[model samples]
Target chain A: MSNNLTIALDIMGGDYGPRSSLPAAVEAVNLIDHLTLILCGNERQIRCELKKLDALTHPRILIEHCSEVVNNDDLPSSALRNKKDSSMRISLDLVKSGRAQACVTAGNTGALLAMAHYVLKMLPGVKRPALISTVPTQTPKPVYLLDLGANVTCDSEVLFQFAVMGAVVAEQAQNIDSAKVSLLNMGAEEIKGHESIKEAAKLLQCSEHINYIGYSEGNDIFSGKADVIVCDGFTGNVALKTCEGIAKLIVHKLTKALNKSLFNKFLALLLFPVLKKLYKRVNPDQYNGASLVGLRGIVVKSHGNASKKAFLAAIEEAVREVERQLPEKIRYKFEEIINKNA
Target chain B: MSNNLTIALDIMGGDYGPRSSLPAAVEAVNLIDHLTLILCGNERQIRCELKKLDALTHPRILIEHCSEVVNNDDLPSSALRNKKDSSMRISLDLVKSGRAQACVTAGNTGALLAMAHYVLKMLPGVKRPALISTVPTQTPKPVYLLDLGANVTCDSEVLFQFAVMGAVVAEQAQNIDSAKVSLLNMGAEEIKGHESIKEAAKLLQCSEHINYIGYSEGNDIFSGKADVIVCDGFTGNVALKTCEGIAKLIVHKLTKALNKSLFNKFLALLLFPVLKKLYKRVNPDQYNGASLVGLRGIVVKSHGNASKKAFLAAIEEAVREVERQLPEKIRYKFEEIINKNA
Candidate 1:
């Protein structure tokens, strides 16, 4: 690897493609002193954006051209089986080949995951890679929730793996050494949940290294009672999207509410600064990156609809993970557990 | 069976016990013209609150005292097996004995459900009861979501039962004569989900009466795409609370954001009406009542922390359910479906 931390960017991915990715990559390079971004996409398109920014003179950014792009509608299997030269795959290859410390993508979620799994494999104890994202909590710090949409029907072992991975991320994101992990259940009861959740809770409680709190209800995710929450991907995905949808619904409803009368509209206009700040606080784009944890390499997935600023946040997330040497740390943690078992 | 609809309320339940329920009952009696409330709890305690409200002289309010109180810590099984004379059970007993058309409570959910099942029994062809609640949607009307926390591990048959029950509620609550129903899944794909959900989808698709749509993701609950979204209680409960948690987190975080500067605080004060309107629109307590559906009798469970107005809202929910004869309508729908199948 080069001396500077290198992050591979899938420039042709997401809705805006290079329009969003290139600007984010350029900004990221300027933000980190020793950072080099391997921007993977069509060279002509990349050059056009670089010319606009007069950034062709920048030594830190390199264009790694890939002809094919993974379309959002393309199945993950199609991307894995057919699109070998696609930017999403080529970018992951850079990480696997040690040319880059990490890879960031705003591509089709399923395709990126399938390609990442095939290219980098998985850590020793992890059967399947999990998708984790930071959620704002009532406390000063945000909590990490894992398996957001990765394993739809996670078994007991996979859920336990999520807890371990979530705990690790929580430690990295927030400086909590022993993050209290809890299984998200229907209720906060020993008798609640499907068999897999109950079984996972039993394992977590028995583990001495992790601070395993029993079961937490969905509300507890924001309650700041636990640093990490583990759940099956199906539940996690539903919960994540539901939160986003409700936020959107509230905004839409509020606009309608405010415009009901002329007095109210004037009141709302006067309150615009406060409302804008409130909107910024809960904006999903602000927390744009989700770590595809458990792969042998570090990969961060940005929201497909991420703005340039939001995409920059994702790039920063990848840099943070790279700085922490997240994959190696996870490997060491797994090895320690294995040694303890032996 | 009575000339006026009578709803039995367990007064000695919930966090504030008689304080919340008694005042709610009085408010409800004044709100609904032909409504009668049977307040079931300790006679002395009920009378004390009644005397304060001069509700003892109110012809619409009836006090039925029970000796025992069911604490929130009381397990469902313990409540069912031992606490037969507890206020929760006694209240349900009124519904069973044809004295009350419905029952309302702000008590421990598990105990209330278990006792209700034992006392009122299930409707024909209905194997289990599901907890149903109305959640605000993008549409003018709120959507009905079932099995909020009733059956953690629901089978295909149970999910189908939820559909039938949900459809009944939607028909009663909203104008759509045939409510479009969707099964909640991790994704919108037919391939995504646990086997039980897949099987439920198959059953719903084949059913003639139900306008069964394909799988809907978490966001669809607020998308106004479906009139009823049915899932296993665990998933539904998780999704419901996650929405509530995110709403709470946003409100909390927004308050912190606004107070950052005196100028911002002043703007917040100017925008107070807009903010208060937004808060009221998404207030959890405003939509406090969760109907326990698929039983022989209607029962509404209010949030334990419900304010007096919220508790009154729960009584209104019970009144609405009674006015429509929700249980009878569900019975007819089930019978029609069963007959069609046969």
Candidate 2:
């Protein structure tokens, strides 16, 4: 591990803005002795939040004031053209300029993708950057799902590349020697899915570097059959959001069931601890960070409506990626593949 | 339904075949006064099951012996050609020949889709049939999601057709006058999804019959924002299966949590009723029927692993569609749209 590391925090991004990011930044700096956070946002607001948290005088914390903040409703294209001084843009710029080893934001996903791509660019031999996150499964270890709304439509080669990048993350991030990678398809049959998927399967099957498994259905995602599940952005986005929706529905139904009567409510108090622990295990907030991998630099995206803990998790994820040298490892893998193919 | 409604049951389909379907068939006929079932499978097994249920001599129940059965692993095209005398095919043929008003099968989905499409054919101007099923939402009424896995990739026109078909099912099935129809996209923005989604949105927006409510994200599916949500089969399949996956995960987690200690186990016993009710409400087994809409005849595809109760629910759903004359209604809607566009 490096003796010292710096990560840029987009404090003005996300729904809670400085309210969530400031506390997370304070907690992060306090937890990691060798860490420094360059807080990117409105200087006055960041300072105010820091003062409220009683961490304004922390030695390792610095603030870089950004004049504009990217709105959730902003178009990615427009945000790229304009909003040059947005907290989101400045955070990526810091990573690009080598002032920070990584960046974390809980901002507009589309805008963040656009700005990060333009600012940091793709790693050599990489077609595109993918949004990768870990989803809880039946086993103790979670499965890594990728292309979560990065490129909406990935062709055969892009999908194969996602498999490679996803494998690297699963291997390095989770310490798996050979992560079993699977292509997410409508069915497990060889003839299922679009032609692109079939072609991608062929590509993955022939790869010596990847421990590629066969296809995985949506239900198999949480079965822990595969260490990494890869799909196009549209499918991945819907799958991830569906998980979020169902979790919410479960919580809602459970709450309603528990609150029906006074006697039941009293019983609920006794059962609350177990339910709370289960909720924490499956909660989307706990798995907040989705890194935009394949970029030249590390960029971890927290949930837009992130809580302080979720944002803090995002920062920790960025630190881990930096320590693992994720981008450099991916670049080397791709280079080896290119050389082998040649 | 009519005074003497006849439906075909594929007793040799699904994982358990007659073990699940025979009991469901017997119960269905006993539950509905005028409903008659033509149970299609091996005569010996059907009679054996019926005798065990003490329904061997029921007047409303009849048996149509089939020599073959469709396996879940069979390819769609091969199943269509090779399994012509299969129980699944005989059931659909009964519907086609006017011997049955509807057909229910807990068989291979791809095979059923292929056979149904080939036998009944599309309603006059409808492009393709879609697998439509209701998903539980926060509101009292569930939303209808279409193209679950029938067509893997839908173009603009096919997606628009799914919207029309989904709306008809939601309107007639749920008795809503103007069911709110929405195009499912990755994001709820104008420029968020693929071009086909945008074009489908334009078509839906201009439709006089459809109460089109712009775009809906995956999270909004369970938010009760739209009564009918339309998407390509790939996306819908992933979303629906993801729902199933999360529900299973929640149940698994809750069961584990409740079984941790003796005190928690006692609490679980006290909490069993409410928890069971919640599980039933969210259980995919309870919502087993997915009708292949936009065809000339009614066809309900139950879960391949449906329990007796779930298979019975599929029978009930098929009866409901037959009574509603869903195909006729869908045909009328498409005719009206064609005339208006002309």
By TM-score, the best candidate is 2
CAPRI category for model 2: medium
- Name every residue pair that clashes in candidate 2: none
Alpha-carbon TM-score of each model against the true structure: 0.96, 0.98
lDDT of 1 by residue, B1-342 (tens): 535889999888888898888888998889777898999999999998899988788998888879998888888999899888888888899999999999888998999888889889999999999999888887888888888998887999999989988998998888568999999998776666889999999999988889998888887888888889999988988988887787788778777877888976876676667666666556553356799998999899988777787788888989888888999999999999889889
Write down the worst ten-residue block by lDDT for model 2 chain B.
Answer: B279-288
lDDT: worst 10-residue window of model 1 chain A:
A278-287
lDDT of 2 at A189: 93
Reference-based lDDT, each prediction? 0.86, 0.90
